[model samples]
Target: MPYIEVIHPDEAEGRLRRIYDRVTGPGGQVDNVLQIHSLRPHTLEGHMALYKSVLHHPRNDLPKWFLEAIGVLVSLLNDCSYCARHHAAGMKRQMSGDTEKYEGCLEQLHRDHPGEPFSDAEQAALEYARKLTIAPGFVVVADLTPMREAGYGDGEIFEVNQVAAYFAYANRTVTGLGVHTEGEALGLFPPDGEEWRHG
Candidate 1:
């Protein structure tokens, strides 16, 4: 159970209802994390504001899909199952329900060899995310040159890094707050197809 009693969608009001509409509009459904947030609407509002500012920042060029992928990866590293599943659902939606590609990204990185088949850019990015999520103090100038060599400008790399950093905070908050999961929502994803194979 959550630290505070989570409110149902029908019961939310004031700022909570407004935030809920923003999060779950156009036939969208609220996730358990949002339900948990219904207990403290102001913090939820602040979170949504931060999320929007980072995700839709005008100067950023990183595709939302790539940023979301990094978020899933970071969530996995953080061992936050709710975030992992939620971000994976977002990635699935962004990938047009390409579950294979989403899972393939994970399989590729799990290779036994030190340097696997991923591109220099992808490898550098994964390494950077790992370092930032696992050990922030160790991230340094030496770690960033690879991203630069991979053609990411300073601003772009900063955006990527900040997204990774932010998700680490998100993962902890969601987990610590006892956010629930609806694994069935993952059924919306399938390996392939116009109609979902599962769910």
Candidate 2:
């Protein structure tokens, strides 16, 4: 249960109701993360917009699966099981039914020190996410060398940075609020299946 009383979708009105409607899917399902922000509906709108722009934007050079992996890694490092489980499921889906590969990734994530088994590109991104989440102060321009060596240009690197940074913000919000999975493992959704363009 949430620490504070959240306005359930059924009880939403006016702008809140519209926001709820936009987030709701075919089965009348809304992500728990969104529901957690129910008390501040405008913030929820901002959150969703940022999420879509970061992870679902068509121009993103990083594969969707890799972005999901970064999300899971950041969530795991923060011990935010609520976000981890949801993004792990999203990552698994991106594996194209390769359950074994997904399991291997999970094992890697669960290790005391992860990333050895992954490619340099994955390791670079994961390392960035780890540092950004756990010790943001230590991050430096040199820390991005591996990602650049892995062929990520400034834009791709920016996307990775934003995705990791967003999840850190999100994980803290969920953690500080005492939010739990609570049988809710829904992934973030894009509004109307639309992608936001970057300048």
> Which candidate gets the maximum TM-score versus the true structure?
2
- TM per candidate comes to 0.80, 0.90
On residues 76-162, what C-alpha lDDT tens digit does candidate 2 reach at each position? 999898889888887887777988878887788776456655678888878887888889999999999998999778898898899
Expressed as tens digits, the lDDT of each residue in 88-111 for candidate 1 is 666667676666776776565343
Consecutive 10-residue window with the lowest summed lDDT within model 1: 190-199
Point out the worst 10-residue segment of candidate 2 by lDDT.
190-199
CA RMSD of all predictions: 5.9, 3.4
Pairs clashing in candidate 1?
none
lDDT of 2 at 83: 86
